[model samples]
Target: MAKGYWITFYRSISDPGALAAYAKLAGPAITANGGRFLARGTAAKAYEQGIAQRATVTEFDSLEQAIAAHESAAYQEALKALGSACERDVRIVEGLG
Candidate 1:
């Protein structure tokens, strides 16, 4: 099966402290569910209409595992901690075999 990836792009972060807290909790939760952080940081550059944003990419063994991680209680706690700290987009995509 193709691997799965959780892709997140933060358009804006209003609360640094909240974001920090979320990161602390979310990172571990993700790893606990067999997710690996491939990238986490600001974009190197933006081209055309692309908007520069903080982005994170996490890989998982499969789509089911990725979905499970997102639905887990630990990640839900992280989401609670995050609240409205940022405006972002999150997606789970299957990788090429």
Candidate 2:
């Protein structure tokens, strides 16, 4: 099956503490649900329309798995901690292969 990926782009951060708190909770929650982080942190550079800000890429077994992980109760808790901390864009996509 094609892999699933969560692509997250941070538009802006309003609270570092909230992000830290969320990260502390989100990491384990994601991993426990079969998510593996592939890349994270701020971009080294942007090309064309790219936004060189904080971002992450997480992989999962399938698209449904990725969606489930995001919608899980644990992740929801993390989201609560992250409430309004930053503007972000999250996309769940199926792998080409």
Q: Residue 95 deviation, candidate 2, in Å?
A: 0.4
TM-scores for every candidate against the unseen true structure: 0.96, 0.96
Clashing pairs in 2: none
Q: Quote the positional error of residue 96 for candidate 2 in Å.
A: 1.1
**What is candidate 2's lDDT per residue for 1-97, written digit by digit as tens?**
9999999999889999999999999999999999999999999998887788899999999999999999999999999999999999999999998
User: Global lDDT for candidate 1?
Assistant: 0.95
Name the regions of candidate 1 deviating beyond 4 angstroms: none
* RMSD each, Å: 0.8, 0.8
The candidate that wins on lDDT is 2
Superposed by TM-score, candidate 2 places the C-alpha of residue 21 at a distance from the truth, in angstroms, of 0.4
Candidate 2 stretches with Cα past 4 Å from truth are none
Roughly what TM-score does model 1 have, to 2 decimal places?
0.96
Measured on C-alpha atoms, candidate 2 has an lDDT of 0.96
Alpha-carbon local distance difference test for all models: 0.95, 0.96
